[model samples]
Target: MTRRRLFVGLMVVALIVCMSTTLFGAASVRRYAYSASNPGGVWYTMCGGIVKLLQEKLPSNIRVDMIASGGSVLNTRRLASGEADLTMAYSTHLWECWNGEGIMKGRPNDNPRIMFEIYKSDHYFVTLANSGIKSMKDLEGKRVVLGPPGSGSSDNSRFTLRTLGINAIESELAFGDAAQALAEGKVHAMGMSGSPAAGLVEVAATRDIYIIPFTDEELDKIVSAGPFFSKGVMPANTYQGQTKDVPVFMFTVYQVASKNVPADDVYEMMKVCFSPEGKEYLGAVHPYWKTMKNDPELVKALGIPYHPGAERFWREQEQKK
Candidate 1:
């Protein structure tokens, strides 16, 4: 009789376990694709840090599969095609993609939603210190690598130079390759983005470099044309041979997601981004992230609508305040 009672109790427990599994299938691990820029870059570094934090804090159900990709332009395209759930992108790149301009011409990608704005990336005009190319006008008829063919720096350089009436003889080269070209005297100068950007750092290590400064009149001309560019400064000693603050024209960058991401997942993700642990980690990983925090104004730039999930999280935080 005791054996019979034990078997019945065991069966009841088994039945309870099955019922719980059915009710909590959402807890099952889910794999999601995340696209980041080239390995060792600002986007990849920040993406890696955030993904690591999420893996630790999020339920095992949310598994992020990250991929190294071509910077902002390609990342934005992937998000629009539903090929990726998350992407690292620049504000101006997507804005033009949405407006059917530049490389994304006529094929608008207006669907990706901002999860958070990360930092302002600036277009750095690098030349050999003794090159004597002090201004954009000096670039006219000179060899300049304006980022890789489809890169944000490439697009910005083309537009910026065009606006200033400096028609540089342009070449499309990756930042690292461009740096090599500059160091080897193959190119007169190159324009690329990011602070302490790896490519520039590599070149600065071997040769004396100078940052081409944008005069207030030059910056005013650029900013007057659109909201995409702003006047900013790269602090002194930011790079090798950089002795003082350099005036720069800047734009913002962001993490974008499909509007389809579950509201709860995004809410939890934002919490992790702002959590003391996450805040500490990202700032340590990248200099730009030193100022990372939630800001409603970050989303005010040109782009698609904010993720509803992101909106929900913001509302909850506001109430807490």
Candidate 2:
């Protein structure tokens, strides 16, 4: 071959190699980004575990990145802006964002969708076991940590407290740090709403304080306000010092994704989250994972409509019925 032809042949081979590399890279890797407000919280831990499981179960090209965020509101906004592929949020806030209610009062997000309900967050107004704080009414004059301003706990705490005619002042702190603050007696009591045996609660309990259970009257007041709030009982043994089921208003925690995420991705994500292996993964991540067993009825309880992909999953399940 002439020198020029040889050079041209080399150039053509280089072009083919470059094109093949680009296609291989695109096909070999799937990138997913996630963020959680309280990285040390149970939800983040469980979600992180799932992400890890995905890495193990998914093709080698799939990569998942977890980012720490400022809880529900921030996560919701991120999802709407297409900054996050998935996030954890409370069902009530999900609705408020969807309908532009409450703290989401002025800004509204209509593009988020529920992938599945994760667990129940039973609101607890806990004081030091020895603090002489017995009920919601008892905390009226005490200094209370309301939880961080935009967190699911903060929203539910304010609503629950208001429902009971108790107007305790709120001190805001990030979720992971709240328990430590409580242990140091920086705040009279901290509001915990979510699953019974969550890591946060475990941290609080290990501090040698008691969990003050809410009264039926207080629980009734919250439920009466809206279906977003419901009665959830925390069995006594859920905590070390507790002995009876503590009745309180509970909120649903859900896994939500942007409206733009593909249906197949959401479907596969849900299946992975609820699978037997997923359950085991959750159990290892946090005791709260024990609360994540798949419940079909939970889809109906979500405050907002399911994502189209989620809806398809439920519809297919229904078709079998």
Candidate 3:
């Protein structure tokens, strides 16, 4: 009877162990990697803010981490390779990568599916106020810094110059260094793309600055180059400047995910990001977030297919209306 009792006790312990494994294993954490641009850029900060929101609002078992990367072009490649679970990239690059055109020629990436439209990145072609470089036409035969190589800003700069038929002596530099070059008169103008970049603000703090505006005819020709380009206006006083409204070409920025990621996780992320609380938190993190809208129409306009999870979220939102 003692031996029988010992066997029964062992069975009971085994049962408990089975139950414990089932209970605890169900809540095991999942980690996802999010890729963004280099540190000190708006994309990196925006990714950090998003990861923080996901941490706060997602189920405790899910965690997201950020990876610093080389802007949009490289981020698209990372998404294609499954090296990044989530990434932020311009709509122009997304279209190019998916279609296997332009810089992404002959190597298509069909894995990236859009999560949402992040914001509009306006082009800022800044020069010293006293430089006498008043227009895009004036940039011809002059030295310019067109962001770092492979960056979205650089691509846009090249596209715009090509479309406008201007041949400027172009060099690639990081945004901060480009701003400093502009201030020190090393470059005639610096073409940057952002919603009033911090580097531009710093340069303006120390020297008189001017943002070269595009004429209506020039804006029309540039936007005609691609469906991704659109007309945008930089409001007066976006930077410390002797100000007036500035017409600029702009492109949409999108948050996309690898198709292999679980649909439910992306759905949950969308819910958290578009929630009133989440938007408020992100807007507080950067003024750019304030420009974000919950509208799925903008995402639909991008011509890229949405992730199944994101599509589900948007469909439900539409049903609620």
In terms of TM-score, which candidate is strongest?
A: 3
Error of 2 at 71 (Å): 2.5
Worst 10 residues of 1 by lDDT: 36-45
Candidate 2 residue-wise lDDT, 16-120, digit = tens: 999999999897676777757564345566667767876676545656678877667677767766788888887777777777776568778776887776777
Q: Global CA lDDT of candidate 2, please? A: 0.71
RMSD of 3: 3.7
Q: TM-scores, in order shown?
A: 0.85, 0.84, 0.87
lDDT of 3: 0.84
The digit string of per-residue lDDT tens for model 3 on 135-181 reads 99999999988887667888888888999999999998877778888
Give the C-alpha miss distance for residue 162 in model 2, angstroms.
3.0
- Residue 179 of model 1: what lDDT? 81
Q: Number of clashes in model 3?
A: 0
What's the lDDT for residue 137 in model 3? 97
Alpha-carbon lDDT, every model: 0.78, 0.71, 0.84
The pairs that clash in candidate 1 are none
